[model samples]
Target: MNANIIIECKDLGKQYKTPEGERVIIERMDLAVKENEFVVLFGPGQCGKTTMIRLLSGLEQPDRGAVRINGKRIQGPGPDRGVVYQTISLFPWLTVMGNVEYGPKVRGIAKKERREKAQHYIELVGLKGFENTYPVKLSGGMKQRVGIARAYCNEPVVMFMDEPFGALDAQTRYLMQEELAQIWEKEQRTVIFVTNNIEEALYLADRIIVMRNCPSSIKREYEIDLPRPRNYVDPEFLRLRKEITGIMDKTL
Candidate 1:
């Protein structure tokens, strides 16, 4: 598919006021995310990766500059951009279907239509038989799948995910990673994922954006030129992983 710009962040900067003084987190960051692209922002904790995601999703405004989605300015969170957080921030009280339908319902979609839409994503995330289960009844990985279903149910143009698999155990994380790849392969929505895991970033991203330390900026971009169903032991894949790990180790 030909790449077209779907999201643009220009001179995006963000700061927080500390008791001591103002602490700059991101500065003059310019990024363009093409449609149907899977881009990962890789950095250690507190390195402003999530902050950048929030900025792009319009959850928080930048201290300076702006985020534009398909040539239109993003003023605040809308149904067009959906987000999944590291913690699987689902409402404990809502059932799986309820959670998935929340977005469309809030947007005034009719009850029957929202239910059908939610069911579509529930099935898409492989939770068809567990539609009525509450968050508390689900496993960690299951809960994250609900979050993914909820995000996709609204048919968002872009999906911003912050370490959606971070909380799962090693085995579960790997399973979820493969599942995510399958979902993205079928759906083909623009995804901006944030993670500190170099391997995870490489496995899921078409391009990886490596960010610098506080007052963060894009340091390097690795366009993963590997074939689908990429083998971990492939020479090129291994080389890129080692190279990215070296850069991360140096920065940390």
Candidate 2:
């Protein structure tokens, strides 16, 4: 409940009834995210990374413990948190401008004001010229751009991204990672991004939390002190990457 800590997950635990039996996905996990901190949740196996995000973001309730944002316990999903998913869930019928403005529009923001705000975010995500384009016509990376813009247009206090770039091709994935890092640099937000990609995690994260698989908990944490626009092949970067990989390799 510190002033600078925008997010807190205390002794969080969750269980699900599976076909086999009751399955525990999270186990008494504790986490705190500082204001405007970019944190990545990385793991080797199918840790409950997504489940943790859902619980924290209020998409699901933990059977025990709590998730707090700004010292208040989360009850359910709200505008203060914006989420981008692996599927790039854009409105197929809506154009880029329409989709980005959807949240504001639903919240009764005036058309002119929302349009101006939407335009700013659209340009910010490098999609100014494609305002009229629909999701069906855009490429994978471009659609994710729209997703990011749409999330930003809400002006959320925290952004929870669950593998937003996981499905992209390698070249496009790398490009999107670079672009996302640049975007985060310009517009700082408390971002909790989940991914299994170590390079992507290192490139974008201010701190990386390595999690243990199924019945997950934080195994290790690394504060990345390297400068922005980090080089993948930099010796220090490689060394850290190797160290992280070695740590997670045990979970396999």
TM-score per candidate: 0.95, 0.98
> What lDDT is reached at residue 188 by model 2?
92
Expressed as tens digits, the lDDT of each residue in 126-162 for candidate 1 is: 9999998989999999999999999999899999999
Model 2, 213-249: lDDT tens digits are 7778889999998998999999999999999998883
- Residue 39, model 1: lDDT of 93
Candidate-wise lDDT, in order: 0.89, 0.93
Off by over 4 Å in 1: 1-3, 249-252
lDDT score, candidate 1, position 111: 96
Global lDDT of model 1: 0.89
TM-score of 1: 0.95
Candidate 2 residue 48 C-alpha distance from true site, Å: 0.7
- Model 2: lDDT equals 0.93
